[model samples]
Target: MKQINSIEDNLEILEPFISGLNKYLEKSRSLSLFKKLPIRDDKENINDRLLEGSYLFSPCGVELRESECNSLALELIDLLKLHLTDRADEINTISDHLLNEKINPHSIILSTIKNEGNEIRKKIRQLNLPEDLFTFFLIYLARPFREQAASYLLEKIEKLIWLYGYCPVCGHWPVLAHINEESGERTLWCVCCNTKWKFKRTQCAFCLNENHESLEIISPVNEESYRIHACKKCKRYLKEIKSNNDAMNFQFDKMYLGTVPLDMIAEKQGYIQESILTVRYDNPAGNELLMYRQKAIKEKISIN
Candidate 1:
């Protein structure tokens, strides 16, 4: 891994690819599927649920209408093939199999949300498609929906107390962390749904190890604002950005893209990325809330 001494140097190196990907993301966000989708509001006993380690919304509880799912999936697939010219051939092959086999796009979207990569890989193998490429594509295709849902639910829970390592909105692990320059407070940013939540600075985001001996920060030379919070116990690392100003306006997505070298460096050091799903099912209250929200979706009941 090449040593990235400055943010500008890193961004300059990845600018071309990042620019194209940003355009694709912008066009994808403008799809009609985001407009027509409904987001359920669930605020009943919100803090209690958080205390019980129950995420605000389970993937099963979030309703993705079949028509919208199919339309959005097809549109995203087309957009990827159009904007991402490098992957055009691969996208075409996967899209052909996905459509011709009459596979319900909603099922794949749900599976991706639930982090069922094995099922997706199985399907990809059956279709004779590239496993890693199609799996990433499916996740990218499902991103907008998760992000939209997160946007709707963020305000409802952002101020509430949530101490968990995973996302409160989507049950996904943090992809990035933001540290306040003045206060030294840490906020974990979710990879799947783009949600942000407050977390303890001394604790490891992956294993929640707070012994201080098992946790360490790896900072690149000449980079004051960037570092990696790594856990020796789990061997998982979270890339972090220290916010100097306008923390609310920080483009985490762009920062994440610009910091690819950080991932490479961390991986080279034998640290792995955090798991997609957190271990929340062990709590009965989490299970109860999951079951309740799922039932509400089935009954068409708007949770108040």
Candidate 2:
């Protein structure tokens, strides 16, 4: 495995992409592009749902207003074209489609949030856009709104009693893990909503496999702070950063971006990166969690 002294070294290697991404992120966060999403403040009700292993936000339950989605999509595409010079022409084409209303931003936003990869691919094919590039742009366009909604919901709830492997906010699998140097506690980070929650150190985040013999942690030589936690039973791996100081200074997003080499190494070793749409229900516990989520979604729809 390739070794690096610090995350900054990795960032230097990915400077061109990182530079463009950083600008996009900064500009996106500055604008009040999204409408204020509804927040459920019924603590007792929330507690009951949490106890039942239900996540706060269901895939289809999130209300991304059409106007806001359209506005944000145009803004993001324009910014992508400006900062990401290599893809200017492609992004400009996407921008024109959004401006002309040939592509419905609202539908695309919903499909992306729901992890409907096939639907996204179909749209890309019809439009003749670059598949991977378009998908990447769409994911970023939807991120800010999801983060906004999750922030609102997070403020109202006092305690999160969720014990499930997937995110408590978005139902997406974790993209990274932070291990406290002193406490040795593992906290999982949701890729979609940026929600954080404590999870079992020995358990597999993908499949919840708890056998010590089946779980392994591997780190690159001379890189003590970084590690990859792999599950032999499920053939899945999660990137981890073990922080020496208080983990407050660690930026999960940057760390995820900086650890591209770890991802390559894990993939080369036959470990699979679990998709956002995948929900593990093979175990009885996982089944119950799924049931609770279904019930929550139904209730949310009925109320709406």
Candidate 3:
């Protein structure tokens, strides 16, 4: 793989993805799905959950009516199709299939398998559809809801979040991590819900293994601000950004975009990205909060 040496190169690689994201954020911001969202009372208490070793509700656990989710998915498809030029024809087919379905967020089978933590690729082998489409749809389709939660909960709990590894709110593992320049404290960043929380510097985010000898740090020559934290036990890697003056000015999303080289290098060394299998709350397709909304659907057919 080619090394990316500058911000321009990173933008070249990430432009397609980032361009669509801004539009998705803007359009979704205007939706009523966020208005009077049904956030369970305890979900907002970030510090409380950390103290008890309990996780806040995953965004998937939040209930927005199906119609709104479907609408968000449809809006996302327009932006997604633009970025997925290689899969344009396949994406069009997926779009058609989605529009024809009465259900929102489309692809119930894939979503169900994803929620159940089943091997989706093997289950959908006969379908022959592009797996990328399914993955993107499942992730971004729920963004509208997740972003809403982030907007509210991030500010609601005005305390120093103590948990380090997984997100306190969404329960998903982090996409990126960074260290404070002064204190040298580390924090993990969640892309799914845009969450940032403090974690132990020496501990591996995946297994919580703090044996310094079992952990490795990979840094490129001349790039003092960025490094890869690899845990030998879990074989999972986290991209870490050191919060220097210049680094502090860069947005986390932009930093994530520019770190493509880091991800490639880490993966080449046999370390996979850090992602935990999100626990299911209720139904096969979404969070347990969907249970209330899914009563009619559940009555129609058994999930198992």
TM-score per prediction, in order, is 0.76, 0.78, 0.74
lDDT of 3 by residue, 40-106 (tens): 5554455655664444554343445566767767777787687768888877876876776633353
Per-residue CA lDDT of model 1 for 1-304, tens digit only, reads 4455476687776666556556655775665544344445466676667666667655555566677677767766776676557778888987886688555788888877766656766776777787656755775667777777766666566476776677777776788888889998888887677778889888876556677888888877778578888888768889999988555667777788678778877888999864453223434533343344344433432332
Which tens-of-lDDT digit does each residue in 255-279 have in candidate 2? 7878877887788889987655434
- Candidate 3 lDDT (Cα, whole model)? 0.64
Model 1 ranges with Cα > 4 A deviation: 1-10, 13-44, 82-88, 98-104, 277-304
Task: Tell me the deviation in Å of residue 280 in model 3.
Answer: 5.1
Best by TM-score: 2
Candidate 2 residue spans exceeding 4 A from truth = 1-8, 15-41, 59-67, 82-102, 277-304
Sort by TM-score, top down from the best: 2, 1, 3
Q: What TM-score, to 2 decimals, does candidate 3 have?
A: 0.74
Q: How many steric clashes between backbone atoms does each model show? A: 0, 0, 2
Q: Which ten residues in a row have the lowest lDDT in candidate 3?
A: 289-298
Global Cα lDDT for candidate 2: 0.72
